[model samples]
Target chain A: MATAKDRAQAKAGSGLNDDIGEQKRLELYRTQVVLREAEQRAYDLFLQNLVKGTSHLSLGQEAVAAGFAGAMKPGDLSFCTYRGHAHTLARGVPVEKVLGELMQRDNGLMRGKGGSMHLTSVDHGVMGSYAIIGAHLPIACGAAWRAQYKGDKDVSVCFFGDGTTNIGAFHEALNFAAVWKLPVIFVCENNLYMEYTPIGDVTAVPQPAADRASAYGLERILIDGNDADVVYRAAQIAFDKARAGEGPSLIECLTYRQSGHSRADPAKYRPEGELDRWKLRDPIKIYRERLLQFGVAERVIADIDAQVRKVVDDATEACKAAPPPPLDIIATDVYADGGWAWRN
Target chain B: MAELTYRDAVIRGIAQEMSRDPDVVFLGEDVAKAGGVFKATVGLYEQFGPLRVRDTPISEQAILGAAMGAAMTGLKPIAEIMFSDFFAVCFDYIANEFPKSRYMSNGQVKCPLVVRTGNGAGSRFGAQHSQSVENWCMMIPGLKVVAPSNPRDVIGLLAASVRDPDPVIFLEHKSLYPTKGEVPDGEIVDTLGTAKVLRSGKDATICALALMVPRALEAAEKLKAKHGIDCEVVDVRSLVPLDTQTILGSVARTHRLFTVEENPRLCGWGAEIVSIVADEAFYDLDGPPVRITTPHIPLPAADILEDIVLPTPDRIAETVRRSLQS
Candidate 1:
C-alpha cells in the first residue's frame, strides 16, 4: 500500500505546485516556525513551574495569531477570548506582561485585576480579552463603529473559539458587524472543541465556521490554520479589504490544541489517534523542514532561538523582580478621571 | 445673557456642546425628526446631521450599551432614556461596566458618558411613566448625578455635566421644564458639585433636588409669611460629589434639617442626604432630620391621586414646621 505523501510524489513532482511568491510566502512560513518555537518554549516554562490557569497553547492554532498580528498596523484594535495569551503576545503585548498577568501581578495587563480571562491594553489597541465568551464581540462592534463615526482608519479583530460559534452574541455581533460594514475581522480558531465538548456536537452548521459568515454577508475564508503562509495571505487580503470600506470577514482557521484545556484535564476525549495525527502537521516542524530545504543554515536557526530565549528570560526576571501595584491603585481610574471612584 | 426657560436652557446647552465637539453625539428615541418628546433636542438633527444626532433602537439596554462603548472609545455621548423609569433596563450596564471599566482598566480609560433622563410624578402619566428614580443611580460608584431645577441652574448644570470627566446621570424634571426663569447664556459655566443656597433664612434649612426645589421654595415662602418660620431653601444640585460642606454648614447654622423629594420615602435621594447630615452633623442638630417625600406607591394615573401620592408644597411646609416645633 502506497502512503499518501509517497503516491502524490509518484504522480507528479511539480504539477501540484506551491502557488505563492518566493520571498513573502517564505518569510511568513518562516514566522510560523518562530512562533511555534516561541510558544513551545512558553509551554516548557509552564510545565516547569506547573503554572496556574489554562494556557490555550497555539500549537496548531499559531497561524491565526501570526497571520493577523503580522499584518496588523498601528492603531488597529483586537480583542480575544480567555485563551488569548497567543493573541495578546501576537499583538506585541510583552510576553513578560502576559505571563505576569497570568500570574496575577499588578504590573501585568489589567493590573492583575483581569487574570487569565481579561487581558487588555488600550494603548496597543489590544482592547480586551474577556473570560465571558461572547461579551467582547459587542465591545468590538461598538469600538469599530465609533471609529467609523470619527472617520478614523482603524480596523478591529475579534477572536473566538470554535465553541463560541453557537453563542447568540456571535450571531448578533456578526449581523451587526455586517449591517454597519464595521472594520472588524471575526477570526475563529476552530480547534474542534468548545472546551471538552466537540464542536460538531454543539454547532448545527460546520466547516470554515465561515460557512455561517455568508448568512451575515461578510467575506469568509477557510484556510489551513497550521500553515502560517496561507493564514497570513488570507488575513492580509481581508485586512486591506476592510480598511478600504468593505465590511467584516469571518476567517475560520482549522487547527487543534496540543495541551489540556487550561492547567486542568488530560484532553483524553481528543480522540485516540487525533493528537499524533495532528502532530504531523506541527507548524514549527514544517517551517524548519522548509527552511532547511531552502538552504537556510541550522546555525541561523540556533541564533534566532538563542535570541528569543534571552529576551524571554530577561522579561521573566524583570517581571519577577517588579513590585505589584499598590492597594490605593484599586480606588483609582474608575471613571477615567477625578475622585469619582468610590469617593463620589 | 438671554432669559430662558428651563427647557430652552438645556436645549441651548446641548446645541452648543454638540456644535463645538464633533464627538459629542446624541441618541434617544423620537429625538431625531420628532426632536424629542420634550423638544429638548429640537433643531439638533438639522444642525449636527443624522449621524451625530442619532435615533437609536427602542431598546434602552442597547442604547446604553452602545453609549458605554461610544464613550469608552472617545466619543462624548449623551444618551436619553425618555423617562427615568426606562433606566431600570440599563442599571446593570451603568452599575457594572460604565462604573467599573475605568477601574478594571487601571485608569487607562474613562467612560465620559451622560445619561440624560428625568424623574418626578407630575404628568399623571401613570406608574410606568412617572417614576423619579434618580436616587437609584446613586447606588453605583463612578457616576455623577445632577438634578437641576430652574432655567439658570439647568443651563449651568448641563454645561458642567457635559464637560465632567466621569459618567454623569443628568436628571431634568419634566414638571419644571415649562417654568420660566432668568437663565444666563454667557461665557460662564456654572460650578459643578455645589449646592445653591437659593433662599437664605434662619429657622431651618430645606434641602431639595430638581422639581422638589421649586416646591421647597414655595414652602419656604409660605413658612416665612404664614408660620413666622425663616426657612432656608438649598437646591442640592449635584446629588453625587454632593456639596456636603454647604449642607453641613447650613444644618450647623440653622440647627434643623428637612428634605423634600418626589421619589418615594424609602431609599430616596433625600434619605441619603438626611443620612449624611445625621452622621456628620448629629451634634449640631437642634431637632431630628425630617423627610417630606412621596408615599411608597407608584404615581397614580388620576391627577388627584397623583398629587396625593407625591409631596406638594403644603406637605413640605408642614414637614418643616413640624421639624421646627418638635
Candidate 2:
C-alpha cells in the first residue's frame, strides 16, 4: 500500500515522474469520458434506427477499460465479455464502427450481427467476446496454449466483470492455464456491484478478486483501476512476463460503475459518501494537473478532446442514418451447404 | 485385412491421420507421454512429439477449445475426453461455438475438429463416468455424430471425422475397446450418415446404433433361425443428418419397424428417429414400431445392475417380436 508520502516520492523511481503519470492518468480519464458521451450519442441514434437489441456501456467504470487497453501489444489478443464497448474503444476501435454496429450497419465490426457482446477484429488480434460470462477465458487459455505449443511469443488477455469471477469456467480456465504454464492474463474489473447485488453480498472473499489466482500457483496483482498509468505499466509488466513463458497472471482492478449494470436499472442502492469519494479521485483531473505540471500545452489536450468529441458526433450521425440488418438475416448463416451427407 | 481390437484401431487411425496430414494433431489428458489411460494414443507422442500430440490439463473445455481453435486455424485436431460424461463441461462450446462457426462465418471457415469420446453404461464407472452422450450430441444441428459399432468402422469413421468439414462427435463405446474385429485392408473412406444393412430379411426392418447394433443383429439372427421372422437389421452409422431414406425405404418394403439404442427410451435418439420415420412412412407400416433401449435412469456401477439397466439382445428380440405381433 502506497502512502501519500510514498506516492509522492516513489513516482520518481520507476522512470515515471509523478507529473507525467498524473498527466497520462488524466488523459485516459478524459478519453473514457469521451467514450461514455459517444456511447450515449450512439444510444440516441440506436433509438432512431432501432437495429437489434440493447447496448452495454461503461459510463462510470471507464478508467480500468482505458487503463488496461492502453497497455496492450499489437499481437496480444484480448477476450472480453458482454460489457465490452469501453474495452473495444480503449483498444483503439474507432467510434464510427462501434456506433455503426449499434445501428446495425454493414460496416459494423461483425457485420452488425454481433451487436455489442460479440465484438471482434482479428486484424487487431481482438478475439471475439461472448454474452455468456467467463466462456471466452477458456478460449484465451486455448490461444495461449497454442502459442506456447508453437513457441510463439504472443500473450492472451481475458477481461471479465466481478460477477464472472465466480463462474465455474473462470476457475477451470485459471487452474488449467496455471498448470500448463500458458501465457494468459485474467483481469477482474471489480466495479463494486454485480448487476444489482454488491460484491460483498455475492462473494465470500470481497474485493481484490486477483487473490483467487494465487490458489492456482499464479501471481495476483491488484491496483487502483482508475489510474491509467498504473494500469498500463502493470499490464505491460504482466504481459512481458507471460509472453516470456512464465505462466498466467491475475490482475484485479478496483473501480466502480456510474450507471446500472445495463440500460434498464438505475442504481439507487449506492451510498452517496462512497460515490463522492470516488468522484473526488477522478483520474481525469489528476492526469490533467500532472500534464500541466509537465508543461504539456493545454491547447494540445483541448484539441485532442475536441477531436474525440467530433468523431463521436460524426459516429452518432452515421448511426442515425445507417440501415438495420435485413429481415432475412434470421434464416441465413445456420450451416454451410445445409449439411454434409455421410454414406457407406 | 488385419484383425485389430477396437482400441488398437483407434490408435492406428489417429497414427495414420497424423502421418498423412501434417496439420493433423492429437490432444487430451495424458494423450502424450501416458499415451492415454486406455493406450489408445500409444506411441503418438514419440512419433509426432509433444507439440503435435498435446497432453492438456484435465479440463474438458480446454481440451475441446484447443481442438476448436486448432481446427479453425486449418489444423485437423482430434481431442479426447477421458470419459464421455466429461463432455457435459464443454457442451456449450462444442454445441454452440464450434458447430456454429462455419455457418456463422458464412462457410468461410471449416471446423475440422473431432471430439472422440467413449460412451455406454459399463466398466462399473458408476453414474458419473458412464454415460451415453451420443444422443445429446446428435441433437445438435451443425455437429455430425458417429457411433461406431466395430473396429473396422472405428478406423473408417475416425478418419472420416478428421476429413469432414464440420465438427464430429465420434462416440466410441468403452466396452467395445478390446472387442476384436477384422478391419478391411487398404484405405477405408466411408461417408457419414450412411446406414449399412447388416442383415437382410423380408418380415421387418430393425434400426440400431452403437453397441446396440450387434445386439439387434443377434436378435435378428435368433428370430430368423427360430421363429422364421427373418427381420432385417440396419446399423445407423451416423445419428445426425440421419439416413431417413434408407430407414424409411426398408420400412416401406418390410412394413414393420423397430429401433435399438443404448440410451434411455424417453426422448432419446431412438424417439427422434421413430418420429421422423413415423411421419414419413406411417401409412406404409403394417405394425406399430417398437424402441428397445435402456430405461430413463443413470447407469448403475454393479455389473448385475447394469445388465438389468442396459438394453440386452433378449429385450431387443422381445421388442422385435412385439412389433411383428402388433
Candidate 3:
C-alpha cells in the first residue's frame, strides 16, 4: 500500500501536510459524527411520522459538506440540491432550526413554509436547497454575477449531483459563468448514480468534469471526497483562483450514498456487493482512523462522539416540542405589502 | 408632451428608470448591440455601456433565473423573454423558483424584477411566435400581469413594474409597437390595479385589454352614432390586482357587461371578467354578460384566417346590439 504522504500528494497536491493537526482533525470528525447521527435520528423520526415530507439523507456525503463548510468564508453564498440536510447543518445552522424545518414548525428556517426540500438560511449564506434538479445552477451564476458587479470577493458555491450536468440549464449556466468570468465554484458530488440509474448510463462521458471543463475554459479538479482534508485543500485552491478573478472552477468529488435515495426508497437497484465495499470506506470511519494515526487519544474521539449524540438528541427533542405554524400565515409573505396598485 | 410609438415609450420608460436607479439593468438577447428584436431597447447600449445593458446568449433560462438571483442580491433587472410564447423555455424559473422564493423564505428575499415580453397575435408570426397567454400568467400567484393599450399606459406601467418589489410580467402586444400616441415628457408612473376609463356612457359597459381596447372604443362610438346606444369602455391595464371595483361601478350604471379580448375564448381573461360581474353585480345586470373573443385555435400564419378568427369592432358592436335587444 502507498504511504499516507504518497496518497496525500497524489490526491491533494504536493508539499501539503499528510496528517492535519489534532484540533482540526477532531473538529472534522465531530462534524461528521453529528451529521451522520442526526440523519439517522431524523430517519427514525420520519419512520414514526414525526418529520413530514420525504427527506433525502446524506449518510455517506457528510465529509463533503463539512469540508466545504470549513473552507468557505463568512458571507460566501452556497446552494445545494434536495439531498442537502447535511449541507445546512454544516453551515452552522442550528440542528434545532433544521429539524424544526423538517417538522414544519413556527421556528423553522423558513417559518415552516419550506419543508425538507427547501431549507434556506440567508444568515448562514445557505441560500436554498432546490427540489427541482439542475434548476438552481443558473441562479448561482446570477449570485456570482452580483458579487462580481459589486466588487465583492465572496464566491458562490453550487453543489449538485452528477445527473444535473446533463440538463440544458447546467450548460447555459456554465457557459454564462465562463463568458462573464463570474466568481463561483461548481462542485459536482458524483455519487455514481442519478437517482436509481448509474451516471455512466446517462452521461456521454464517464467523468463529467474532465470531459466538459475544457469546453467551457474552466479548470477541473477531481478529488477523493470521503477524505475531508483532501476536499478542504482542493477547495482552497479553487477559491484562491476564483478570488483572484480567474473565473469559475469545477470540482468533481467521487463519493457514494450509504442509504437509498429518499426516505421511502429501498435502493434495490444498486448492484450486489457494491454497498458492502462502499461501507468499508465510510467517510466517518476513514477520518477517525486517520485521526487516531495522528496521535489523538481514543478517549478523546469517544468523548467527541458522545457530545455529538447529546447535541442531536437535544435538537430532536426541541423539534418535537415546537408548534406548527398558524393558519393566518397563508396570506402573508406572498408579496411585499407596499401599498401597491394591486394590494387594494 | 411628445408623441411617441409604443416601442419608443417602452424604451423611454426603461431608460428613465435606469437613469433614476443605478442598480437597474437590462439584459436580453441582442438587447445591447442589436437593440432588441423589436428595437424596444434602442440607444440604451450607447448610453449605459455594456455592464448595465448586457446582451446575453439565446438562453431564456439563464436570463430569467439570473434575473431572480440578481434581484435578490441587490440589483433590479428587467429581463426580456424575446416573446411571451417562449416563456415555456424558462417556465420553471418564473413559475416555481422566483415566484415562491419570497414566500418560501418567509419574506427574507424579494425578486424586484420585470420580465418584459411581446404578447398577442396580429402580425402573422405563426402559432409559436404569436400568443396572448396573459390569462395563463394571471392564474399564477405571486406574479403580477400587466398589458397596456397605448404609448402613455405602456410607459407608466413599465416604470411602475420596475419600481415594484415583485416579479411583474409586462406583456407588450406586437401589433401596438408602432402605434403612435401622445405621452407626457417626465416621469409618469401609473398604479397597477387601477383601470382607465377610455369612454363613459350608460347603455353598456365594454371591458377590454391590450389591443382590444382600441377596438372596443371604436365599437362604442359606432353604437352611439348609428344605434343611439352609448357604451362605456373600461381598459383593464393590470390583470392581477384586477380593478373589479371600477368594473362593478360601470356595470351597475350600464346594467350590461360585455368583455372583449384577443386571446382564445376558453378560460380566457374575458371569462374571468364575466364571472366577476356575475358574482358582484348579478341583480344589477339587465342581461347575461357577453364575451367577444377569438376562436379556440392556434393562430394561423395566413392573415385572412387570423382576421376571420379574431374579434373585430363590427362583431363587438353586433354583440352589444344583440345584448341590448335581449
Per-prediction DockQ comes to: 0.32, 0.40, 0.58
Q: Tens-digit lDDT track for model 3 on B1-326? A: 99999999999999999999988998999999999999999999999888889989889998987888788888999999999999988999878987788788777778899999999888988899888989888877788999999999998999999998889999999999999999987898888888988999999999999999999999999999999999999999999879899999899999999999888878898898888788878999988899899888989989998888888999999999988986
Candidate 2 residues A1-344, lDDT tens each? 33454344324222446533545555575667676677667556545655357777676567677766666767777778878887777777778777777667766765565676667666666666667777778877777876776677878888999898887778878887888788988888888888788877878775536657668887556677666666677778788889888988888877777656765456788876877787776656555565676677899778777887888888767766767666656545445455433322
Which 10-residue span in candidate 2 chain A carries the lowest summed lDDT?
Answer: A6-15
The lDDT for every candidate, in the order shown, is 0.75, 0.76, 0.86
lDDT of 1 at A135: 61
* Candidate 2 residue spans exceeding 4 A from truth: A1-34, A42-52, A103-107, A336-344, B69-75, B100-111, B185-187
- Report the Cα lDDT for residue A308, model 3: 86
The candidate scoring highest on TM-score is 3
lDDT of 2 at B215: 85
Candidate 1 off by > 4 Å: A1-60, A131-133, A161-176, A190-226, A252-306, A335-344, B1-5, B59-62, B65-69, B83-92, B118-120, B123-129, B264-267, B294-306
> lDDT tens string, model 3, A93-161?
888888888888887888798889988898899888888888888888888888888788999899998
Q: Which residue pairs collide, candidate 3? A: none
Q: Could you list the chain B TM-scores for each candidate?
A: 0.97, 0.96, 0.98
Deviation (Å) of B159 in candidate 3: 1.3
Order the candidate numbers by TM-score, best to worst.
Answer: 3, 2, 1
